[model samples]
Each structure stands twice: as structure tokens, then as C-alpha cells.
Target chain A: MSAAAAKAKRAVRRPVSIASFAQSENVRRDDQHNEVEMLMPVVAEVFANIGITKNDIDFICSGSSDYLIGGPFSFVTALDAVGVWPPMPESHTEMDGAWALYEAWVLLQEGEIDAALVYSFGRSSPGNLNEILALQLDPYYLAPLWPDPVSVAALQARALIDAGKGSEEDFAAIASRSRKDALSNPKAQVAHDIPVETLLRDEYVVSPLRRHTLPPITDGAAAMVLAAGDKAREWSDKPVWITGFDHRIETHSLGGRDLTSSPSTAKAADVAGVADGPIDVAELHAPFAHQEIILKEALGLDDGVTINPSGGALAANPIMSAGLIRIGEAAARIASGQAARAVAHATSGPCLQQNLVCVLEGE
Target chain B: MSGQTTAEDLGPVTTLATPIRLDFEFTPGVAQSRFLRGLEKGRFVGQRCPTCGKVYVPSRGSCPTDGVPTTEDVDLANVGTVTTYCVVNVPFAGQSIEIPYICAQVLLDGADISFMGLIQQIPTDEIRMGLRVEAVWVEPEELTPSLASVRYFRPSGEPDADYETYKDYL
Candidate 1:
């Protein structure tokens, strides 16, 4: 390759490290704290971990949904938690915090800023999340039918079973293992050691998905600080370097595409270089149990890879923040010496229509 | 030969209204709950920020500038100045009050921020900046943990506050 071509490629692969991460304790209903109150301590802890303040941060980006709060410009009120006075360069995404982090990573790659703070918060308990999520469907056709998230997910689960991709037993097994792993996670909302056999005995909330397979309705928030190069080293001795970061999206028309497979995830994984090296741990944002199976196959994760050490989203899915939490959990594993290399996956839209993959490594 | 339609053939169908309502159980959180409770007792309470020492009425849990919990509570006087206001000449839906009513941002004594309140018992033309006003509470029996306990604000009959006092709030 020409030297100029090599330089251009190197610029695209600039390293950004997750310097710090903190999340509110996942809870079924956080009646005592609003979104701003929930995020205050988490943001404080994230900055304090790196011995920095909001002043040290060059940019701020947050992810949240207006539908969750039943009001528009909810994120503007949320910025109060960050003390963004005197004005700062900021942006927001209506999607998950993982995508907010992606925007920050892109800015850091351009070498415009040294650090950025990314956060997301959601309270699914306040509203009928099933009906709220239905609003995201095609307004003309699907939204009028008001297919709740569980029923839609059940459709995907049934497709997986009929296509011979997996079974109800497989879904239960994923739920069983994820929740069992969550027992050790202090931030997890639902952590149990229930056996898959017992889970299978329970009646399905929707066909192919029992109550155990569904994620807990959680109200929580998460915050992370990303720094590049010298600032990253200053923040931590073992900075989890984001070697590859990429996201992809599939068509929003659910029936037009296959539900049994996650083509978007596969494409994101390829671009993110998930298979370039041995992945010791993989954190996936799979709110539904069977979705984990599909994501695993899409990402091409093998038997040697450990999945959802933080119990994944089955233990606690706080909508906009859960996907970002997956990235933080994966980075934490690398920072703690539990793994040298890790891959984090976040999905959005119905049936994994959007996917973001980030490859992290520690030296 | 062709499937074509002229504008004259099609009637105007420019708008489609899809009204949506999603109910939510709002939890006011620790800070707002205290402020709401104070309203029930016919009192104005504000929280003092530990970092900046700025008082926020009905504290939405933290100081917007400091991002820290305003733990210190301060009892505030009802009487304050109208830093700024708008005369609602045009009627809007769900507007119970008569047209040309005054809606003003009232900055209570010792509070750093201003809160919106309906200015009553005064001409819309006379609702100037720095006009002194006091909250009019609902009947004692109607008191509850809500801002609704305070019916509205009217001219306090006190002297207008100096512009220098609340210029920062404006």
C-alpha cells in the first residue's frame, strides 16, 4: 500500500480508551430518584474515578428517549445532572448510550478532543413500556396493531425455533446462565440461580419465551468517560483500548427480512474486526434470551468465549442505557485482568435491526 | 393508456391527526417531594447547593450548575419580584383564566432561581419587571402535596424590587 493510503487507514483506527465507567444500581422501580438525581452520583463517580471533573471533559453526549418520559426535550433537563453551565460542546441521541459513545469515538478519532463524557438514563417502570415501544413501529400499519415488545420478540423466538436455529430449551439455558452469573453483579436488578428445568416448567408469557427469558423492567442510568492517548494513560494504568468500533443497521421492515438471523450484527462484527484475535469475553445487549443465541451466531463467537459475565440485559434492561452498559461491562473485564481481549455488542430497534460492536484490548 | 390523476380529480387530504396518550406514574424524587410537601403547608421552600450555595426552589433534586445535591433547606418568603413576564393575550386550549392574563417568572427572596407563577389581580399592562407579588394559596382544606395548593400570585402591595436585585435571575 502507498504511504499516504496507510496514513489514511491509521487515522480511521485511532485508539480511544474507556477511562472510567459507573452505573446506578439496577432496580425494578426507582421511586426515590428521578432521572437527574439517578444520574448525579453516577456521573460524579465516573469523573471521580479518573480524578477529573466536568471541566476536564472536552465534550458531552447523552442518550435518552422522549417517549420514555412522556415529554419532549427530556435530555435537556437531564443535563442538569452534569452541571453543564457556561455552555459546552454537547450532543444527544434518541437511541441507546452505545450510539452516543460511538459519536464521541468518532470525534476523538478526528483528534479534536481529548476526552468526552457519555451517559444514558431510562425508567421503564413509569410507563407501559410494551405500548411505548410499539410507537416505534410503522405508524401506518404495525403501530395501529399495537404489538407489544414481548409479543414481537416472541415472533422472532418462534422463527428461530422453526428455522432450526435454536429451541425453547436453548432460550431457557441462556436465561438460566445469565441470571446465575448476575448473582455476583451488585448492579444487576434480577439475579437468580434457578435451573433451566424449573424455568422451562413456568408458563410462557408469550410462546417460546417464558417469564425467565424476558428482561427485568429496570429504571437506571450509566455514565462513561473516554480519553485518547496521553489522557487515557493519565486516567488509568490499564486503559481498555477500543481497537475497533463500528455499527450497522438493517431495514426497519420486520417482515421483509429474516428474523432468525442478525445480518446487521454480522456486518458490524466484520467491520469491527471481532474475529481478528481471541475474544476472552463478550458482553451482549440481548434483552430477550433467544436474541443472545442469534447474536452469538451472528458475531461468530465460539465455545471458548465467555458471554455476559455481568448477566447481560436479561438481568436488567433499562432501555437506552443497557446497550452502553454492555460496553462498560466488557471494558471493565479487560481493565480488571479477567480478560485480555473482549468484544461488546449493543442492539436497537425491533428484532436487532441495529447493531454496534466494539473490540477492546488491554496490554 | 396511463394511470394519471389531476389535482382537480383528488380532493384535498392534507392532514391526518393521530392523538396519542401514554400514562406515567411520576415520582417527584426526594428533592421535589420535600418542596411539594412545603407547598402543602403554605410555605415556599428552596434547597441550597453545597458547592455554589445557590438556592433552587422546588429543587429538581440538584443544582443545575454544580450537579450536586442541594441538601440544605431554606424557608423562603412568599413575596418576590417578577423578573420577566408575558401577557397571554391569545387564548389557548385548557386555559381557564381570562384572556390578557399575566404569567411571570417569580424570583423568591434568597432564592437564586425563578419559578413560573400566574400573576393575578393586576392589569396586564401594569405587569412590569420587578413588580412585587405574593402567592395566593387555595382553601386550607384543599391543601395537598402539590403546587396546585398555591392558586396564583397577586400584587403583594409591597414596593417594586430594584432591578439590580434580580438582574442575574433575568
Candidate 2:
């Protein structure tokens, strides 16, 4: 293991495991419900899966963005779905749900809370997501130019091609494999069994990125229950322990960073001890097809490893919740005895500027 | 060597102004849709939480206290008590009302929550907590599925309500 990985392992405090996971059906639009309505069922199911109730949880954290709904404090209203009566201790982050899970994990390490709930929701159908996402860039430089997500990802794809790291056919192959694998995931929004050659023939949304390379604009919510130590063991017969967790971020100035590679993901993987053991499955949150290739290289996974068994983000990318869903998907496999060890990865910002890596094992 | 930049050596730092416009179609969930439909019929409708029995105006579909849907609809009186208020004196980009107007939280009778509304027909100095007010409706032709149907709230000329009546709302 790397020196950094050894140091991270030494910092471990309490063992935390995922007790349960649940998600709403990813769809192009959920006109029938608002953010609160969308999360109600998901929160219920996550708790129910563990045969527990909200009364048993010690803390609640959620992730969401008000920009998606064009309102301030959107999460405050979403909290109603959890019925936080008696005023439960709660927190929120304007980031992907994976960060919220990280916060819960930190709290669990303190040994004060035995269990916590983490959730996130996003409704991209309410507004034009491309324009909304551009606002997340540096307001003075990138936002003024309105560089949408697609164009930014295309730049990364072009960089990969220019650096001889990957080719257009490789991008198509990633997309084809992901969507085809999603056929088994009932909650997935996009699933198909098409050939890679057929996808390559599609018109390009941006140069170096075809329409199939981009993720669908989906509205969805996801929730998970996390318990530490003995509580975790009591909750599930086969607990998926979070052995290692770490995250890193890069500068927002896209031009200053290398676009063809993901240094942040590699650093996080090292700190998370991703290479310490043999990985049976990996669920990478790569919204763009080319991004999956970059992440695979950064994580240093071998051909023998199974990737995106739940189709990954290329199948159902629901903005804020997609990253956390990766962790849940990986943990579910471990809990079901489908895999002994897994690596779940989540990325945020443009060109994978921010990344979180989690290592899980069945016990 | 001393490191410093003289005024003459420094050039002007360029800056640019940009406007961001994002359009959205907000779907008010089941409770809010029902409330809007009630407004079209000149009624104040709210939903009562089954667990807590708290009536939320502009029903938010779920009771935040219990984490359950508020299924029981309750019609509230247009008359309410002003729990608190503020006088807006500054102008903003989208200021529709004139400055120095009273914007108050009105706790409609039978509703557990208070909603923000404009206070009119009373002198600014006369607007106070616990003051009774009634809704002022626009012409029926202008009525739509919006809270705008009620133009504002005016003093009802009744005696101020007891503090106990709106203390919880504040």
C-alpha cells in the first residue's frame, strides 16, 4: 500500500456499515410529485428494509441544490418528508448525496451516534439542466460564457483522444455496456441492449461526444441507513462494512487542470485503500461515458473486476443523488452476497474535478 | 530585494457583468394543487397533519413535523390576525409594490401556520401584532390559480385579538 493509504488506514476509528438502501424510479420527469413527495417513499423504504423506524435514527443529513428547483432552502421543505417532529438533529449540503454520506460517516466515527440516515433528491425536469449546471462554474470566468456540461465533457473527451488515452469507439463501448447491464435494474431510466457500432453511428451532441455519451436528465431521490459497529451487525445478517472512505477536490479553473486524467480520483482511491484487496465489483458515478474510462484508469481496476453491475450513472444519472446511489449500489451487492469486496466512486464538478472513493466489504 | 508594485506598474484589472436567466415550471405537489384550486373558488384551504393535527397554509403536501402526507383538507376563514409585520422601504429589481408598505405574516383562523401577505387600507403606523385583518379580493375576472387572487389584507375594524390567539404563530 502507498504511504498515504497506510496513514489513512491508521486513522480509522469506528466501523460503520450500510444497513439499508432505497431509491425512487429514475424518470425523465416526475410531474406527479414534488421533491418532498418523491423522497417520502424512498425514506420509508430505506428504513423499512432494515426493519427499523425513524425513531431509531440518531441523525439525518441530506444533499440537494436549490438551483434545480429555482427556490431557496429547498431541502428545508424536503425535510418534512422525514417528519422531523420533536426536532431531530439534521443537516444539509448543497452537493451530491455522497458527500452527505461522508458527513454521516464522520459523525459515526465520533461514536456518539449509532445510526444515521442520508438522502438526496433532484428534479432536473423542472428546468433546463444544462443551463442550470453551468451556474456551478466560476461565475466571473466560466459562467459568463455559459459553458454547459456537455461542452465541458466534450473538451475532456477531446483531451483524452488527443493524448492517445482513449478513442471514440471506446466511449461507445462504455455506453453500450452500461445501458445493457442496466436492463436488470428496474429503477434505471435508460436500458438497452444495442451494439457499440450502432451507438457510434449516432449524431454527436458535441464533438467527441455523441448523444449516447451523455446521461439522461432524470428526476429522482435516494436514501440509505447507516449504522456503526454492533448496531450494524444487529440490523443485517450480512453487513456491508465501509472499510475506507476518502474524497479530494481540484481547482474550479478548468483550463488550469489536466482534463484527460483524474488526479483527484486517483488520490482518493489511494487514501481509501482501493487497491488493498481484490475488488469484485465497482460502481463508478461517471455521467459521461468517456468519464468511466478515465475513472477505470485512475482506480487501477483489472479486467477481471466487474464494473457497473447496476449500469452506473450512464444508466440513471439523477444529479445530486447519483453519486450516493453508487455507494448504495456497491453496498447492496456486498449485502446480497453477490460480491465479497467492492469499490464505489462518486465524482462532482466539471471533468471529475471532485471525487470520493469508498471501499466496502461483506462481513 | 524589496518586492512591491508601483501604481504606474499595475494595469487595470478587467471585469465583466453577466446576467443569468433560468426558466422553471414548478409543480406544486398534491396539497399545494388543492390549495390553489381552493383559491380559485375564493376559499382558504389547508391540510391537517394526521399525526400532529397541525394545519399548514399553502399546504406543503407533507407535515414537516411528522413526515407524513396531510390528507385532511380544512377550509379556513379569510379573516386572520397579523402576527408580525415589516415595512419595506428599499427598492429591489423585481419590486412590484411601492416602498414603505406593510408586509405581514397573517395567521388565518383555523390554520396552524402563518403565510406572508401584504397589509393595506391601514396606516403604516397602525399596523401592529394581533391586529385583525380580512382578505381583499380582486375582480373575479382576474382570478387565477394563484394566491394573487387575494390582492392584499385590510384592517377589519374589529378589536385586536388576544396575544394567546397568535402567540404560537409568531
Give every collision pair in model 2. Answer: A83-B66, A83-B67
CAPRI accuracy category, model 2: medium
Q: Write the per-residue lDDT of candidate 2 for residues B127-161, one digit (tens) a residue.
A: 89999999998888888889999999999988999
The TM-score obtained for chain B of candidate 2 when compared with the true chain B: 0.88
Candidate 1 residue pairs in clash (backbone atoms < 3 Å): none
TM-score of chain B of each: 0.87, 0.88
Candidate 1 C-alpha lDDT tens digits along A304-324: 999999999998998899999
Q: How close is candidate 1 to the true structure, as a TM-score?
A: 0.95
Superposed Cα deviation of residue B63, candidate 1 (Å):
1.1
Residue A240 displacement (Å), model 2: 0.9
The per-model lDDT (C-alpha) reads 0.91, 0.92
Span of 10 residues, lowest total lDDT, candidate 1 chain A: A3-12
Query: In DockQ terms, which candidate is top?
Result: 2
